[model samples]
Target: MSIPFDRAPTATTDTQLSFDSLGAPLHEVTFVIVDLETTGTSAGKSEITEIGAVKTRGGEVLGEFQSLVKPEESVISPFVARLTGITHAMVDDAPSIRSVLPSFLEFSLGSVLVAHNAPFDIGFLRSACERLDYHWPQPTVLDTVTLSRRVVGRDEVRNHKLSTLAAHFGTEVSPDHRALSDARATGELLHRLLERFGGYGITTLEDLAAVRQAGWAKRQAKSHLAKGVPAEPGVYMFLDGTRRVLYIGKSGNMARRVRGYFNASENRGRMAEMITAAQEVSCLPCAHALEAEVREIRLIGELAPPYNRRSKNPERNSWIVLSDEEYPRLSVVRSTTALEKSSAIPLGPFRSRKSAQAVKELLDTLYPVKRCTARVTAATLAAHRPCVSSQVGQCGGPCAGVTDRQTYLSGIADLFDAMGGDFSSLRRLCTQRMTRLASEARYETAAEVRDAMRSAMSTAARAESAQALRAVPEILAHSPGPDGGLDLAVIRHGKLAAASHVRGSRAVADSSAAIRATAEWVPAPGPFPADTDSLPEETRVLSQWLQTATLITEQGAWSLPRSGANFHAQESGTVRLGDAV
Candidate 1:
């Protein structure tokens, strides 16, 4: 026979009822081990089929409460029924959750709640409490699963399951799988775990809770420190309080390397500047440290994070092209133009003007071309004032009207063709020059031509190789962020390499801002531009690296191309006075 309850009674409506029965406490501090058999995993769609509790004190069972709940849901799954042995027919006449919850709460008074995977049970209970318009006071819930993991050393136990724990402690558990039976078994398991690990500073319930809460973080930090992240590696990301990925980087020993960011006195100032801007740290732990280098390069090309040093301006992100007009004048144009006009004939989308000019000089040295800014026009030639290039014989005196327009155009066309993926033209020219020089016994000239040919071939080959690099995963482009400007930086191993800055329109920006406000950014693959032969080595390397590296951005889905540099222009419009422009 069950013990009679002695607690104040409460009035109830047709849908609400109360039960007040107190169970005995366990240990110096009492606990109520509780379990619930639910209709389904989803608390919203399902209802509790059974509720069970066992209260104990000083290693002795004081009292127990069990009830079958008639759920509002019309049907329960066969699997749930079999697992709990609580069929719909059996619970058809049973009390409702609203009628049973109060009774359970009364029995659980003056006791800390304990269960295996406490969140699973507590989550359902909390949901029910919410539906009943009751603010369930947050209880000091203990999880037997976590306690077992802590007590039985995470690695030593193949499984910390209830049955396994019971077997391990040689404690007999009857009527297993039922709510009341499981609750009793859990109570026993907790007793054994507490006794075993109690000597190792797990004496108090609060101490155990703290240990469990910090379990994963402590374990990971220890592992990272012990392994000693190497210095010869690639990139890393520094995340902050908001879990916002604040920075991406490449370095060997990323852990030891990143310590510098936090170790200095200046760290607080720098971190304070970025912390409110971030939350939750994460990284791509690479095997080969150099993989970090490669990853860093890929990341910069892709994400274009704000903190990276690369230019965020789209207009500045351009390439040098040799124009197709007569005399083949060199021109600086946006990288986006190269994607639109296939015949612009590019030399580079180099990181800087200096790098682009250096490449131009190298090309000029290998293949003789006019380097002067002087225009070779009919009027200028007729005037007979030989341009500086003509005086130096570098221009073939075209400005002196010595060359026809047809010839000038042809020469310009040939120059562009040779530079634009026509390795054979350059190769043929180099070979012819080498042959002529060799025939003249000018071996040095022949050697120079051969070396130039080799470099040109290598440059061509690299470009072709870059073309073969695969497109990034489609899901990557869907990263969550507001339509406000987003800057992504790609770091490989540990070096800053590539970056992209994206701006969304007001409409799109508004949606993205809403997502950001809620802090619901889900990582997605972003568009990674491909490396073209016309792009400089640094840009190419950065582009390829960005393809593989981690991306961090605010929330929005704006389509961008996978190759060549291009930035979306924010549509021009005037804001009205009420718009806070």
Candidate 2:
């Protein structure tokens, strides 16, 4: 992908001179207004017969370059002669294009070049440079046509053509069918356009570039608000003039994400308007993206910023609850309160009903958790006929009295164990089945079973851990931090109760009381994604780290890091828990 000339000649050219001051004063910038007359429209098919340039600064012309270039085309087309008034006889005595290209390149060096229709002029020059192996410097280019389009309304000027603008501005010189005359007129037009550019804050060379950039000038006025954002994993809030949160978002690098709001690539008009309205930006640094993500979700649910459109409908969240019947059937429901009221085993805070359904379907594919929605007692089972699921062997057929209530309940307990984060037995069984299927050349079936098993494992682990954390009355834990310190956190019913950091020799002892976090701002937590996504690939790191997090219970007894929560899978010879959001 390297270009033939990514860098210019360092020894003789001014290309290496530093110009870090993209915000230099307007008078300091050198404008090399250039124009070209060619034999035809396209550089690939035509040859440059003449090049004209006028370099200026502070409304004063510093130098000028003009040349007639002879091409290999011995005769000019009648149309080209009539248009540019340059015939073959005119350029016959002129030097070849290769000889004139170097002078023009040198004249435009270390300067912002201006042309009426830049691509036409610059394309011709670039073609000559490429053909002759004369490395062209990457020069700053300004198009007068584009500048006029930005500065003058169509109602004021009929068009941005050189003749039309020259007449409209009343410049001393006018563009003719000649290179030098047209270039001089275009240069005057450049000065006129620059005079009106102040309203756009186009005081710098970069500012000049932003004028023609796609919607970039609109964002320049407010970029200072994001300058203070830190470059680390965090949550950012955009605030309006009234200090109300306009948007809440999470990113691994807060500064970078905030800066993206000012970029031209943001295609959504709503996003653009939101950025324009933003007057201040705030940041909340996090341990990692996970903490930021959870905090963002909770905050959005709490603040309900108008610009944030997703994860705002917690009322629509679904959970998988095992119905409390003699023949319990796995089901999906929508309320968090149902967990305590129904006395049924609950396993969710799924983002959507579709996700809950997918997890349920995956579980059913691996384990026959009776797909029938029927309520069953021994009498009811004996009286009713089995559904098609029973005939197809997808269900255990407890409704037809084929399997007794106790055996069916035993299966339900197994389902509970499988869903509650105890995945060792399921893994061993699925592994055996997958290996056997592969050996029998049923690769597709093996893949299906393997995928379903993995999906169920992830879902169960996520739901069970989240459920277990939520069910806990209170717990506290400490982890090592930078510089021989400890970071302490208090957990109550799944969300943080308090958090703090202690440094130096008093770290361990002071952490219990120095803790500084609260659940007041933490929105009620439940139903989080365990393993459903990736953005920039670092998303799962925090999740994997949180899986086996140790907790000190309120009763001073250790349930996790002591007795298993059963929500962990056996990997190799070790138990690994699910990733959290």
Best by TM-score: 2
Q: Which ten residues in a row have the lowest lDDT in candidate 1?
A: 1-10
In order, what lDDT does every prediction score?
A: 0.54, 0.67
Per-residue lDDT of 11 in model 1? 12
TM-score of 1: 0.35
In candidate 1, position 434 carries an lDDT of: 74
Residue-by-residue lDDT tens digits, candidate 1, 92-181: 999888899988888887679999888889988899999998668787888999778865865665698888778777776753778899
Per-residue lDDT of 1-581 in model 2, one digit per residue for the tens?
A: 00011121101111121222325677788999999988888889899888989999988999999999888864578988998999888988999987888878888889998899999999988888898999989898989887788668878988889999999999999888689999999999998888887665466665566455445656856767767787755689999999999999998678767766763435577888898888889887664444566567656766779898975755566777776666677778875455544335566556568777866775675566678877666676667788778888877788787788777767656667665556666677678878988999999988877665655555544544444455455556656543344445555455544444445335444455434322222233334332221111122322343445454435333234322333343342233534432
Query: TM-scores, in order shown?
Result: 0.35, 0.58
506 in model 2: Cα distance from truth in Å?
17
How far residue 376's Cα lies from its native spot in candidate 1, in Å, is 42
